[model samples]
Target: MPIFVVERRFADQLEASAERLDGINRINADEGVRWLFSFLSADKRKTYCLYEAPSPEAIRRAAQRADLPADVVTEVSGRLMPDGSPVPIR
Candidate 1:
């Protein structure tokens, strides 16, 4: 699977209520899109979600099913760390 970054912008402040978040999780699982995590802006108007999917289209489909906005979907590949060094897995 390829990793994708999905960006969503809201007209007003956004808050992921428990019910909404749960629905998102359910949709992700049902659509076969792995929702690794997400980062919401401090102002709560924007959200950046990281997901692993077969393709960008898969992500879009999942967003549609979830009834969430998919402003931009970008494919990305990289390592996660403070530096560029790889950390040993236990």
Candidate 2:
């Protein structure tokens, strides 16, 4: 699985506006995607989610179901470990 960073802008819902995020979480679970963590911007108008998904399309579909604006999605690439160790090859 690969990691993706998604930034979302939610619709207005007054006090219940926060529920949009809950919906996103549920959709992610239903899609078999893992949400490593999420953060609300200091301004409280946007959100950032780090997810492990099988593909970009899966994440996109999940976002669509949540009804949140998927403003941006990027694939993250990195070594298996933080230490710059050589990768084992067959």
Pick by lDDT: which candidate is best?
Answer: 1
lDDT per residue as tens, model 2, 1-90: 788888877665223345765776889888878788878877667888888998878888887786666789988775355686755321
- Count of backbone collisions in candidate 2: 0
> Candidate 1, after superposition: displacement of residue 23 in Å?
1.1
- State how far residue 11 of model 2 sits from its true place (Å): 4.8
lDDT of 1 by residue, 1-90 (tens): 788889999888886689998898888888889998889999999999889888888888888998789999998876568877865321
Q: What value does the lDDT take at residue 89 in candidate 1?
A: 23
TM-score per prediction, in order, is: 0.81, 0.68
Summing lDDT over every window of 10 consecutive residues in candidate 1, give the lowest-scoring window.
81-90
Query: Which residue runs does candidate 2 get wrong by more than 4 Å?
Result: 11-23, 79-90
Cα TM-score of candidate 1 = 0.81
lDDT values, one for every candidate = 0.85, 0.75
User: What's the CA error at residue 8 for candidate 1, in Å?
Assistant: 0.8
Please estimate how well model 1 matches the true structure, expressed as its whole-model Cα lDDT: 0.85
Residue 70, candidate 2: Cα error in Å is 1.1
For the record, the alpha-carbon RMSD of candidate 2 to the native fold, in angstroms, is 4.8
